[model samples]
Target: MAEINASDVMKLRKMSGQGMMDCKKALAETNGDLDEAMTLLRKKGLATMAKRADRSASEGKVTVKSSGKDTVLTSLCCETDFVAKNDDFKEVADKVADAALQAAPGSKLAEQEIEGKKVSELITELVSKTGEKTEIGDWAKMSEEENTVVGSYVHFNNKMGALVKIVCENPSEKLQKLADEVCMHIAAVKPMALNKESFDQEVIEKEREIAKEQMKDKPAQIIEKIVEGKINKMISENCLVNQKFVKNEEMTVEEAVKDAGGSKIAAFERVAIG
Candidate 1:
């Protein structure tokens, strides 16, 4: 059998996102065959992650930026809170987000430019300089009518961020204040959907299973009714528009939007530490 070294295990861990000991074990099991070890690790990770899908990812930084009606938001995550707080990490996060705003969704980051440098090159340099693994966690952009202005709230700390695009109906201090409040709420409340109707099919289906399990003792018809009601309740609570307003708690976010009159929230983006 080939000798499995520390460097070999480190390489496998980074490539497969598996635990260090697992990587070492996989290498030993595969007789130090890197490719075979990677495959084993990936398969194992798939199984492990599936079982722990509910694990909360709470270590990440939110970044938001806006240009007119065009807005973008992103999340950058690391292995620990200590790394997330690193100044170098934050700088790289900002640069990556800037590069993302310049590119459209589903495009290659290698093709994007930041400060006249390709993002791919920047990533390489940053990794070497920081001595830490860095990857772009998420990227999203929103745009409205060209004439309208985009507003952003990056929050008190780098912990959370938001971008709000407004459509001209009219711009007033009141409207801006309302928009700011909405952004703050996004960071604090973390709604999973924009409206009840907008919940993803997969999310609904998963919730349906949970509801059925919870109401299993009831009559079949009653169980289904209960499941449907549970799904609706989840939508109202998890969706932004239907959620109770974070600021007031008495009104739904939708009500606040309607009260804003002519001004409309064309789009919004929010992210928090994982």
Candidate 2:
């Protein structure tokens, strides 16, 4: 058996970010071979991740990155808020977001490679280091077309994010600013759909049915009026364009866009890690 020295164990710890005892054990198992010990550590990490597959990773950071016309958002989840706030975890999330932007939108990020290692492997390494379950929760990308502008916003805690694309006949700095404000509104209000037309018909019908149930005792004509009023109110609350703007609550989001110029929201996406 080869002798494992303190120096060798510390070196492996530095290289692998594993605990001192874990590094020492790996080195001892590998007969003091640093390269072999590193591989052993990675294999152990993979095994640990597999064992933790059933654990829920609800706490995480939402990272957003944009270049010119393209924007991407990614949610990197872990088991605890302490790990979520770690600098290394945040850096990993940023790198993952950047890589996701280059790949196809909605690509399986866990299968994609970054710096020669699959992202899932990197996450497994993280789980090993932090002693917590880790995974990628969501991935989304948006791109601007001709005469369109893209904007994004990440919340203060980095747990929520939004992306917005606006189409205009003539795009300008003001219009872009308005689009950014719209993204902020999205992060705050979290509207379900862009407008009444975009809302799912089934969802509308469900809401109508619920309202009818609530007003079952009323006269038929009165119930009809009440149901219509309730449905319209729901649209104003849940539809992005109909919802009141955050900057100026007096006006709806659609009115805000029209007032800023003639631009309209082409698409918007919101992501959150809770």
- Tens-digit lDDT track of model 2 for 76-159: 998889999987788779878877977897678888888888887777767777877788887789998898888788899888
Instruction: For each candidate, give its TM-score against the true structure.
Output: 0.69, 0.91
CA lDDT of every candidate: 0.70, 0.86
Where is model 2 more than 4 Å wrong at Cα? Answer: 5-11
Q: Compared with the true structure, what per-residue lDDT tens digits does model 1 show for residues 1-274?
A: 7799999999987765556887889999999998898767655534544444455545657777665555677776655677678776677678877877788865776568888777755555444333344556566777655435355676766768776665556666665677778778877788887765567889899989988999999988788888999888888888877778887888777677667642455666776665
